[model samples]
Structure formats: structure tokens, C-alpha cells
Target: MQNDWEWFNNNPEIKKLMQHTATQGYYFILYYMYYVSSASSVYAGLAFGAPIMDMILPLNETREKIPSFPTNYGIDGEKYFILLGIHGFIVNAMAMAWLWTTDAFIIMMVYHCSSLFNIVGVLLQQLNMKNCNYDEQYEKKIITEAIIVHKYAIEFAEFIEKSVTKVYGFIFMVNMIMMSITGFYAVLNFEKRKSEAIRMALFTVSQGIHLFLNTIPSQCIINSSESVFHAVYNCKWDELSIKSKNLLNIMLTRSSRPYTLTAGKFYPVNFENFGNIIKTSLSYLTVLNSMQ
Candidate 1:
């Protein structure tokens, strides 16, 4: 990650943002632990009290096939509960660890990618400084530097899309489906066990937050890329030689094309698309409610 943006190593502001983002990602993991613990307690209760129902996890087949942890409740009730508690803790911890790691990675990629793109806009603005009374040679040098930075920014954007988009996309879809199903079940079982339903509510909210957090940064990338057009157009093109004007025009043309981060190239990760996802999920939830 550091190597991807090595050009900005000396930049204090960029460094600060990167540090803040990393710290924030870790904080998210800590917050997620609370939810995982709550959900785990609920699942453990189901596993112990209603082993035949298999509501919490698909463990019925495995439980029946494998002589797993002590399930002979009549023979060893307390021992079974003790081992089950330990098993639940371990399983929950491992699942949450995997989830939290993925969340942190996505947060890092989205936040840093957005920041890097915005930094490119700042560089573009620098290229069109009206106050500078430099000679043509100096102006050309400034333009060249800006062009190099802009190219790197585009390359980094491509790298992020190709590497992160599909994985993030799949995760997003799965989370959406889970949120909907969990929400439906929570509503259906609310009166039976309010506490358990509340845990499901928390899970649904966290999933929503994860989706929104990723979506906002993607919109930031789009907005920053669009801003480049204004930055390039504001240059004093008439004052420069035809060659300089031509170069600025090329930059303007490039900036005019919106650069966006997408999920599988099917769902554009922006505010508009996010709203659509919510709307579609709610529609499904409505159908589920009617069936129930």
C-alpha cells in the first residue's frame, strides 16, 4: 500500500490521513467484536437448548455424522455445556476475526483510494495557478509534473478496481442478503425472544453501515475526478504557446471522463446505486413479510 503511493511519502497531510484511516479501521474491528459476541451468545443458546432444530448453523449433519463434542446431555449435562461454551467461543472468535480483517482491508482500500484521487485534484489545481508569473519553461515543467501525477492516479485507480472490486462486490451482495434474511427472521421471532431479535437488529445495522461506508468513498472518487475538469479548464490557456494549450486540452479531455469505482462492473458503488440496493432489498423484505 505504501509503495503504491510512494510519491506522497514526504507529504505530511497524506501521511496523516493514512494513519487516521488505519486507526479508524482498527476501531471498526473493535466495535464489530461487540456485535459478534452478542450474536454468538444467541447462537450458542440455540445450539445447546435446541440442537435438533439446527436454526443457528447447519451443524445437524456434522453433529449426527461426527462424534463431536459431548452431546450426550443426559449422561454428561454440565460437561456438555462447558465444552459447548468453549466451542462456541472459539468458533465465534474465529468467524469474527475473519470478518473484522476483511472489513479493515476494505476500509483501507476505499478510504485511501478516495484520498489519493482527491490529492490528484489538488495537484491539478496547482498546475493552473494564476498567480505564478513563471516563464514558459517553468510553466511547462509544472504541467509535466501534474501530468505525471495524474497518470499515476489513474493507474492506482485501475489497480484498486481490478484487485478489490470483485471481492468487495461479492461481499456486498452476501451482506445484503444476510441483512434481509436476518431482518425478516428477527421480525418474525420478535415477540418470542426480544433480546435475540435485538441482536439481529444490530447485525442488520452493522451490515448497512459497512455497505454505506464503502459506498461513500466510491462517490468521493467520482466527485474528485469530475473536479479535475474545472481545475484543468481554469488554466490560462490563451497565454501559453499552442503546444502548452494542446497539452492542457488533453488533460481536460481525460478529466471529462468520470473515473469511478464499481463492484463487478455491474453495480457502481455510489450514492445513487446504494439507494437502489436499499430499495431493492426493502422490496424483497416486503415480499418476505407478506409470505410470513
Candidate 2:
């Protein structure tokens, strides 16, 4: 992993990619934080009859709005409510931190793996026989490095697949359900409860974004892997020595099969599948609305 990090750090193109990904990740986290805070405020308002804006202020009113414990527990005093509020706030903060950290980790892995494939593609595309000093040795070295990086990328992606398949699968299923239910509710309450409908709509959109974050990087890996074949084919391989030609052939064969990330070892995670998931969710939402 350290070697891989070194390789990534040394590559200017990969560095740019990482920078762009980091910027996007930053905004994603900000959006998540906003959503969580807004949802928490709305929940507090519903639970304790506090004004939503007032809930944003850390004061006695907010403390009073903390979720009520059982009266039988003998901890319902005003002083205890302050402690309860602090404890609840800490717990929520921890849970949100864990959630975002796990998501960011998964996204970072996927982006790195995709970037490796892209780097290999760039290397293959840069292969040139027309250069005055080009030789079989140079060709062999470049192709070998590309092949090695390609292999590393495949291994990394497989590791990611093995590690996150169950988690992604579960999230995928839950997101689908959440989207369907929330979308239905959003539409159902649009006339009667505008604020609640907007909240439901935002929740549905959040689920969609989460699914996109998972699948889009997987699609990038697929696209980058496929680019390898095109890069190899477009390169001046015919001018190479027989041994170099053989190496190109090996790479061609290997690159022909694009690596993929899967959910539950069942669905290939990609833009196409992402669209299908949305369609299926909407279909379910329609059915649910009709049943209601």
C-alpha cells in the first residue's frame, strides 16, 4: 500500500485526479452535515414541540427538547435533561462521524483503484515507436510497467470488492427502499404538509446521491480498464520486436476483460445499473402510491 501511495503521489495526472476527488468529497461531506443538522432539528421540533430554529441554539430550550427518557427511570429532572442532551449530542456526533468516515474510506479506495487503471492507460497511450531513441528495451520496460500497474489495479479493485461487497449490497438495498418510500411520502404530503414533504424529498435525494457515489467510481474503473485495450490497439505495436509484440498481445488479452465492482456479488455496480436501480425504485414508488 505504501508503494502504491508512492506511485500515486509521483504521478502528476493521478495527483490532479485526487485533488478533484478531494474537492468533491469535501462538498459531499458538507452537504451531509447540513442534511443531518436539518433533519435533527426537524426531529426535535416534532418530538418536543420546540421551534426548529430555536433548536439550532444551544440553550435551555434545546436541552429541554432532548429526547425524553422513561419516567420510571427517575432521571427526568431538569438537571438530568442537560446531561441527557449532552450525551445524546455526543452519541449522534459519533454516529455521523463513523458514517462519513466509512463512506469516505470506500470512496477513496475506489478512486485510487480507478486512477491506477487510468495511469496505466495513459502509459500505454504514450508508447511511441517514432521517437528517435526508441528501442525494444524501452518498449518492453514501458509495457511491463503498465502491465504491473494494471495488475496492481486489478488486485486493489478485487480487494475492495471483497471488503465492501456486503456493506455496499446492504446499503444499496436500503437506499432503494428509502428512495421508494420517501419519494412516495414526499408526493403524498406535498399539499397537506409542505415542510414535511420537502424533508422527505431531500431525504430521497440524499439516498440517490449516496447510490451515485458508490456506482460512479465503479463505472470509472470500468471505463479506465476498457481504455487500456484502446490504448494498446492504438499504439505502434506493429513496429516492435517479436518479444515486445508478444507482451503487447498478453496485455491486449488481459485488458480486454474489464474489472468491475459488484454489489452482493450479484449486480455489477455501474452507471447502467444505477439507472436501473432508480427506475426500479420509481416503479415501486408508483405501486406504493396506488396501494395508498
- Candidate 2 has a TM-score of 0.76
Candidate 1 clashes between residue pairs 3 or more apart in a chain or in different chains:
none
lDDT of 1 by residue, 1-292 (tens): 6784576778776566556655655665566656556655555544454344445666636332111232554555544654655665676667767876776666566556656555655555554566556567776776787778677777767777787788778977997788789789788878986656766676677677767766765776687677667778876676677777888888888988877788887777888888887777778778898998
lDDT of prediction 2: 0.74
Question: What local distance difference test score does each model get?
Answer: 0.68, 0.74
Q: Residue-pair clashes per candidate, as listed? A: 0, 0
What shift in Å separates residue 241 of candidate 1 from its native position after superposition? Answer: 3.2
Tell me the TM-score of each prediction against the true structure: 0.73, 0.76
Ten residues in sequence with the least summed lDDT for candidate 2: 63-72
Which runs in model 2 stand beyond 4 Å of their true positions?
7-92
Task: Quickly count the clashes in candidate 1.
Answer: 0
Location of the lowest summed lDDT over 10 successive residues in candidate 1: 62-71
User: Cα deviation of 209 in candidate 1 (Å)?
Assistant: 1.6
